[model samples]
Target: MDARASAIAVRDESCVGDEFAPDIPGLKARRFWIRNSGCVIAAALLVTLSSTALLEPLSDVAPPTGPEQKKPVVLARTRRQSVTSPKKARLWMPRTGRPETLDLVERMGDGSMSQTSYFDISLDLNENASGSAASSASAVAQVADTGANPFDLVLQDALDARQLMRHSGLGYAADAPKAVRPADQSNVTVTPAQEAMLVRRIVSLPVQPERLRDIKGVIGVSEQDFAQLASGLGGDVVRKGEQLDLIIGQRPAQPNLSEILFARHLAADGRERLLARCDDGHFQLVTDHRPYDRMVAEALAHQAAEARSGSAQAVPKDVAALQDAAADYPKLIEHLARRNVPVKVSLQIVQLLRANGIHWSKTADVPQLDFVFRTAEQGEQELVSVTLKGKGRDRRFYRYVSDSGKPEFFDDAGRSVSKTLMHKPVSAGQLGDGFGWRVHPILRTRKFHNGVDYRAPMGSPIVAAGDGVVVKIDSETGYGKYIRIQHDGGYTTTYAHIEGTPKGLRVGDHVAQGQVIAYVGSTGLSTGPHLYYELRVGDTYKDPTKAEMPAGTTLRGRALEEFRQQIGRVETIASTIRATATSAAHSAVSALTPGSDKQ
Candidate 1:
């Protein structure tokens, strides 16, 4: 067509306000340029129009009402400004400090649509509905007299979190890759709203015996110790590759000490931070790098600010009473270990309590506190709750003064639970020899067999019989590869002729009842792949199947109520942290290889 004709066609179809040519569906504000004979072009004209204009048939259709009608509004493809000199992007959401670039907003769990707001999620993170403060003061005083050191207890508890693995439960996998949520992303959760929901769930969860115990222990720290505890526990959220935020599920929140009372997280550096949580919720630092006092001062200032704002507030903690409980915690555990109580279960219980906020702490110095309970077997002893032989009141020592004039407290210890035992260490095996005198297969003489033997394949997994520390893990001329675990009540169990334990595990490391400690094999003196097990009461060995050890005990009265309450907590957090089912036996792990640690 001629220039004149082409011009007329262009003007009629796409000229300004032309009805014949509809706007493009995708491009928001499109600019069109008209040219004559491909020589010179007129200035481009930018026009704003709807994206749905092109799809007239589909765009005209209305969406369903009610639930099905809920959907994020799709912002049409907007025509960007001039390519020669574009404008800078304006920041919107504070989390990323960048303009919204996503195609569409995600739907909430309730199927409701949400617009991009200043924060990642609009749910208020500072919402706290806890009353632990009102009761904590009295409880703290009661526990402080019990000699619990809250600071030391928390520090040691981290070391002991791994010990809780003794109980067979699913939890955070030790070998699982570190979860470092990116700054723009939420922790293990998908969004902040979801995280808030999880926090709510955790809050609604009744304080279990273990967690209450832990929380109590934590609250007992001296103010001085509390500061130290904060520093020690306080560090950049990410250690190595493991993001503390992901581990603790702490996302950065605006640091408003006046609004957020408790210290949740304080920034460690410009980008990273240290996270903490209370029964209520979490706190965060705005900028990284602040002293411990600075954060606490915020709470103090917040308290004052609240007072000025004329709002009711709970008093902040000034000291740590459970400070002494730290020393007493392990001591109490040791005492139970020396007794007929299941040491593994007891230690785990202590660890669980240590890990939680228990209100009570018993120390050796607590004037006349002696725990008395019934034994699990024939040798067991059960008595009425009465004054002991030399009961005397000692107000100077502790507050719980017994009616018989002694500041003594009595309660049932150890519950009637399954005795820690490995029915079969080998995944697939059979009893080859009984625990008694037998004709020595290799020695060719009648000798007393110290342990029962399980004949199995060369490389089957072997677990601990009960919870205990591996006192010895070495090989000898007779026992090829052996691991000896010292249990409660002066009892020690040995597994001989095993492949080996994993690296990182040493003699002092703790193991759980069902934790896989070794792989079955013949290391020392053995005919084939067989596990030689030995149960020793002090010096003399006993039959594994016949000997009646204090397996577990049942709690009654208040203690039972405490246990029933505490188990939920122990299970709640512990359930999420799981170890590899195979232990050091994983194919690629650095476990002791076959014949590697032979004595």
Candidate 2:
């Protein structure tokens, strides 16, 4: 049969399907004409037989299903070939303008077409090929004839390209690469208004305990938990690396005396007030309300009137009457003389007072008067010093006033009896709070205490720790009325929570060791009347009880000779006084015993 007749027969067969034929009558007429003509019938039979023989190699492959069958078919020549097995195969399409570039297309099982460069696929296949030249050629011919699916081969090439791009640090994508945001970038959105509101919220938070106590009460937390909360508030949180840290901040400074008074509405106006006065230069006093100046003048005049009467009766009728009337007998007498009391009468009264157990005497003609007194503890058993006026004095001890005018006691050898720094500034005070870290009672937070506390009675005398000049006399919220004294060898001592200093005590004034500087009081953040004493070397604080201090000065030269000379007389008097007191005590004990009278 001719090729034209074979082509015609193939076209007729393709167009003659029962479900796809456009005209049934035309199809029937064509079938009748073909059947009647023997040549046409023979040609049709030959075409069918030849087509079946040509497509016999691809009979094992399933027909293209779904969308793949809809693709346009292109005719290609194939050679008869035999292969034991073909692993994968693909359809190759040549590029329009570039003969070197070929597109290898494969239909996936899911009816998707994947296309890749033919050269790339060929190179990969060459690298992976393990068969001989003849076997490879035979495999290619069989693939072209049978149209075998290349899904696996195309997927493997795609995977290789992706891995290569990744290794080269060029990430692969189906479309264009997009700009990726950094993972560390903050996602939080905060505006200026929001930031300002947050700052205001933090600034307006109440810090005082009175204002915050209600929060704990409402939250129903225990005292310990509340204290923990307060400590947390006082601290700050910081981030370091991948972890967080809590940092505690320094405590705020306490308010001063004036600030405290002003907060409590007790501060007086500093502006001067107008005063009303009579033309005669006397302040006009009113019954409803008296001005401050007028009230002060009246008090002075009343005190003058009383002083006049008291001066007239300077010498009391008896010692008992004088003792009952005068708080300080010697001072009262001196005051009378200063108020123009008769000199003769003042001397007579002084001699009479001296005879009546006063023991007051003058040092030759000097104005300095000395007094002798016995302590209730030792009574007359201890020989009271004629020079020392107060308690805590021993007859065996010799007092030496330094060139600096600071008095210190010494033994016969002239070694100082006092320490360089006193461990306790208040003699009668008991140890209370100690130095170091502790949970604050009022603040409910952990804090470091820079000083030690001494508990003593209110108004009890507070003395200097050593011979030093007063540096600061000021009031603070925490320290109240406090005094700082600068001593030798970089040593400084602070006396705090004091009621007041002596009338003449001021900053820059020299205070001697054991000199009464101030009185104990609960003038600061104190639980009771006590003295807060601090010891410092330069700017660093130290525990007063444990700190090693400099050695006390030793008397030498003329001072040493004078101290030794006085020690001998003081020792003799002390021995005589002790012996007499022992004898008297023995007599009293014997009189009290039941069989003593008979003995």
Predicted model with the maximum TM-score: 1
Residue-by-residue lDDT tens digits, candidate 2, 1-599:
58798568646755465565555575556765655685777889999989978997876554565666645555455432322334434322211111111111222235433322211111111122332333333443333344332211111222232332222222223322343356523343333321100000000111111222433332222444334433433422211111110111111231111100000000123222222233442223223211221222222222223223433222234323333323324343433222232323234334333322243233221222221112121111111123322334422234456555555554446655434577888988999879999887667789998989889999999988876788999999989889998875467899998999999888889777788999999887887899999999987999987775642446668877766755553443334223322332233233233443344
* Candidate 2: Cα lDDT at 505: 87
lDDT of 1: 0.39
TM-score of 2: 0.26
Model 1 scores a TM of 0.27
Reference-based lDDT, residue 379, model 1: 26
Residue 373 lDDT in candidate 1: 22
The reply for model 1, stretches above 4 Å from the true place, is 1-411, 414-418, 551-599
Which candidate ranks first by lDDT, i.e. highest?
Answer: 2
lDDT of 1 by residue, 1-599 (tens): 78798567565654455344556642213324432322332222212123334455675355455666656666454432322324434212121111101111212235433321110101111122122333333343443344321111100112121222211111223423355458734223442222110010011122211222222222222233234324544431222212121111222242211121223221324243444433434344433212222222122222222223432221123123222232444333223322222222233333333322232333222222222121121222221121111225421110122222222222223333224345565667789889888999998999999889898887888877765678998889888888998874468888898888876889888665667888888777788998898889988988887665542222346755654443343332222111111111121111112322121
For candidate 2, give the lDDT of residue 538.
82
Per-prediction count of colliding residue pairs?
57, 0
